[model samples]
Target: MFRVQKLLVFEFEAIYEPVLVEGPVVLVDAQGNGLRQYHMALTSRNVVFSCDNLFKNSTRRGPSDEPSWEGRGQDPEIECLELVSLVPLECLRFNFYRRGDRCLMMLSAHQAHQHLNVKEPMIFEFGGHNFKHHFWYTWRERVASIRVVQPRYSEITGSSPFSSSDVQLEEELTVQVQVHPRPIRSSSGIFVRCYSSSGEGY
Candidate 1:
């Protein structure tokens, strides 16, 4: 009984050792209809999606001290794995949201074929409050590291930048007008107007 329990524990650890997050993901359409279902495993190097067979061929032998069962005598050299899609480390865009107890992550890149893309993004749904929090911080740091700087010519020329609507006259001038009173037939009235070439008028 002790040997049997030890063998089972060893097999479990080996299968999940390299996985960061493993859960069911659904590829949905524009109308939010599920197009397909896949079991996904997120590792540091790749996002592996498996269909039909998951962990079916992951059986291996334990240590020599642990007695093996009848079928577990020799370790198999070749194993069968069926994968639907495998996304590489160049996943450019990452977006995620939490709905109730499940979390959904969307991964996309410059080209749709390089990463997972659909009419509606593939919704990676997983449970557990702590796992959701951990996934958020890990991916947020990755996305934040890529900084895109927009070129500004003003910075190189050492001048303040202004918009088209913010333009103003380069210089200002003051004009002085002297008004002299002149006598008319009944009432005396005189008005003097002055203009300056610098754009000031009186």
Candidate 2:
């Protein structure tokens, strides 16, 4: 539903070379159809980036009888990409009502070092859906060695049912990479998520 309507890029200076900072946030809808609402908040020790549903019925024209029915519903899936240092960070929230019913939200990042002449797809599956996307970053640090760490999960609200000692039921996938030093951009492939049922319960 909420496909990337557009992509705007910008650059800024960080305090430290290869700054120890939380990676940028990129949200993509798994369902890929219908109108869905989104709310996001990004903040650091000093810098704060916050925004709520950027696209809603308020900005669009609806049917005359129901002027508010701006096709803002849910999507089969939605994709959101947020650049941390961008100026219009607050405006990234929007409705993918046309296909918002079944959506998959994804958050991933790439470091400048890993973004060289790499052309392969990375896929993630969650909530009965398989979401896909690519990664690209430019390296500027002169130090031959750099470290990049991405969080496993952005937010955790409640505890899980499984315990540490219990037998693990899920499968894990591993990837091998070659490192290099240069300004590189890595492109990930398109993400897809399939659902057997519709509506918002997940």
> lDDT per model, in order?
0.37, 0.22
> Which residue runs of candidate 1 sit more than 4 Å off their true CA positions?
1-17, 53-81, 100-102, 112-120, 127-202
lDDT of 2: 0.22
lDDT of 2 by residue, 70-110 (tens): 45553322212332232111111111111232322222222
Which runs in model 2 stand beyond 4 Å of their true positions?
Answer: 1-128, 131-169, 174-202
Q: Model 1, range 77-157, lDDT digits (tens) per residue?
A: 212224455555444335555454444555444353432333233444443345544444343332333221213211211
Residue 97 lDDT (model 2): 14
- Native-structure RMSD, model 1: 34.3
In candidate 1, list every pair of residues with a backbone clash.
none
In model 1, the Cα lDDT at residue 161 comes to: 17
Best by TM-score: 1
